[model samples]
Structure formats: structure tokens, C-alpha cells
Target chain A: MPVYNARIIVTLRSSILDPEGTAIEHALHELTYTSCTNVRVGKYITMNVEAESEENAREILDQACRKLLANQVMEDYSYTLEETEREPA
Target chain B: MPVYNARIIVTLRSSILDPEGTAIEHALHELTYTSCTNVRVGKYITMNVEAESEENAREILDQACRKLLANQVMEDYSYTLEETEREPA
Candidate 1:
């Protein structure tokens, strides 16, 4: 079986108010980074999926994101997949 | 002035414990996603950085990551930078 590394990001909808991000943005401004704006924060998740092929790996991860990692009503998710050599048993 | 979209990911160092990730991994197993392993979670941050050039944008974001976005002792951070057209005033 080939093992794929999946990196997933779950972000809030643009219209959502992200207090965490807003606080960070304010902190940055206080730190003299006044030009930075519109800060938003999300989740970054990574895991290994062992499957027969790349497509299978993606399917499994997509399911994970849709079913568990993200909330459909308020959040969106995206993932990047890369194949890695299977670890020795 | 050029505007850049910065996407930053801050992850815990490998040796650090990630309870949030562990709980999710267990939930995945219960959901029958047994092939998923070594799940780790981090923060994804997006912001608009208005700077003179790509180099300046990278520098500013790097500083932000170091100063506040990541805890140096337990976390590691990386970012991708893309230039975007300045929004019309």
C-alpha cells in the first residue's frame, strides 16, 4: 500500500467574524505592522492515509474533511495530497 | 504599493504532544477511517500584507510569525506569499 500525506485547511466563510484573527490583527498593528489587514484564522490538519492509490487516498481524506473536519454551514475545507514511500514494517 | 496575500501555517514541533489531533484521530477510527494515522493539527492564518514588493511582504509576514503567530519553543511556522492587485480605493 502506498501512503499519502494529506494537508488540510478548514477556513471560516469570508463573511464570518473571526475574533481570534481580529485579535491577532490588532496585536500586529500594535507591533507596528499597520499595513497588514483583513486577518482570518483557520485550522491546519495533517495526517497519513494508507491506500491502494492516490485517488483512494484523496477520497478518504475528502470524506474525513466533509464528515468531521469542517462545518458546512460556516466553514470551507481544502486539502493537498502528496504520496510518500510506505514506511518499513 | 503591492498587496500580497499571505497564508501561514503554524504547526507543533514533532516531539510535542497534540491532544486535539489525537482526539480527532480516535474519532476517525470510530468513523471507520482506520487508515488515517499520525493526525496533527495547527493554525492556518490568512491576511493581506501591503508592502513595496514580494521581498518586503515576506519579510513582514516572517516577522509577524516570529513575533506572535508561533511559539518558538514548541511550534514551527511556514508561509506562502502571493501578490494580488491592489484593491481600488
Candidate 2:
């Protein structure tokens, strides 16, 4: 089976409040980078998926995102896939 | 000031133990996604930066990443910038 490196970016819906991002904004302001604003934070995940084909790899990745990596009700996720020769750590 | 949207991804160094990732791996395994492995989790952040020029926007973003967005000793971060019409919330 071929191995695929899946990089997923999970972001909260714009309507949701991102307190951590707001906190980071204040921290940046305190650090004198007041020009930085509207700071929203989310999740970036990378995983290795072993599958029989590229299409199979994508299927597994999508399922993983929906089942565990993201909360579909309040968050959305996007991913990029690449072929890799690595396995799970 | 021109506003730029900065999207960043922060990931722990490979040498660092990502307990969160490990936990997710177990969850995936439980869900019968045994093919997915080496699951590493990270952060995705998006912010607006007001600067005088593209160069200035990049500079502020770099500073934010170094000082607040990522832990230099344990994590690494990278970003992409795009001009936007949004402001702080």
C-alpha cells in the first residue's frame, strides 16, 4: 500500500467566538504589534494514511476529519494530500 | 492602513511529543481507521494586519509568529499573506 501525508487545516466558523485569538491579539498589542488584528486561531493536523491508492487515501482522510479531527457543527476543515514514504511514528 | 489576511500553521517539532495527536490516533483506531497513523496535530491561525506596505505586513506577521504565535523552542510556524478588506472584531 502507498502512504499519503495528509495535512488538514481545521478552522472555526466565522460566527464562532475565538477567545484564544482575541487573547493573542492583546498579546501582540502588548508586544507593540498593534497593527495585528482580528486574530482567529484554529487547528492544523498532519497524519500519515496508508491505503491502496491515492483515492483511497483521500477517502480515509476525509472520514478521519469528520469522525474525530473536526466538529462539523461549529468547525470546517480542508486538506492537502501528498505521497510520502513514511509510516506512523 | 492596508489590511492583509495572514494564515499561519504552527506545528510542534518532530522531537516533541504530541500527546494530543496520540490521543486522536487512539480515537481514530477505535473508530476503525487503523490505516491512519503518525497523526500529529497543530494550529491554524488567521489574522488581519494593518500595515503601510506588503513588506510591512510581512514584518509584523513575522514578529507576531516569533513572539506570540509559536514557541520557538518547541514549535515551528509558517504563514501565507493576502490583502483583505476586514478589520478587527
How high is the TM-score of chain A in each model? 0.95, 0.92
- Tell me what TM-score chain A of model 1 achieves: 0.95
Per-residue alpha-carbon lDDT of model 1 for B11-67, expressed as tens digits?
Answer: 999999999999999999999999999999999999999999899988898889999
Off by over 4 Å in 2: A86-89, B85-89
Q: Estimate the TM-score for candidate 2.
A: 0.92
Q: Candidate 1: lDDT of A56?
A: 93
**Candidate 2 residues B1-89, lDDT tens each?**
77988899899999999999999999999999999898999999998888899899988888888988889999999999998875467
Instruction: Show the lowest summed lDDT stretch of 10 residues, model 1 chain B.
Output: B53-62
lDDT of 2 by residue, A1-89 (tens): 78888899999999999999999889899999988888898999998888999999888888888988889999999999999875457
Stretches of candidate 1 exceeding 4 Å from the true structure: none
For residue B55, model 1's alpha carbon misses the true position, in angstroms, by: 1.8
TM-score for each model: 0.97, 0.92
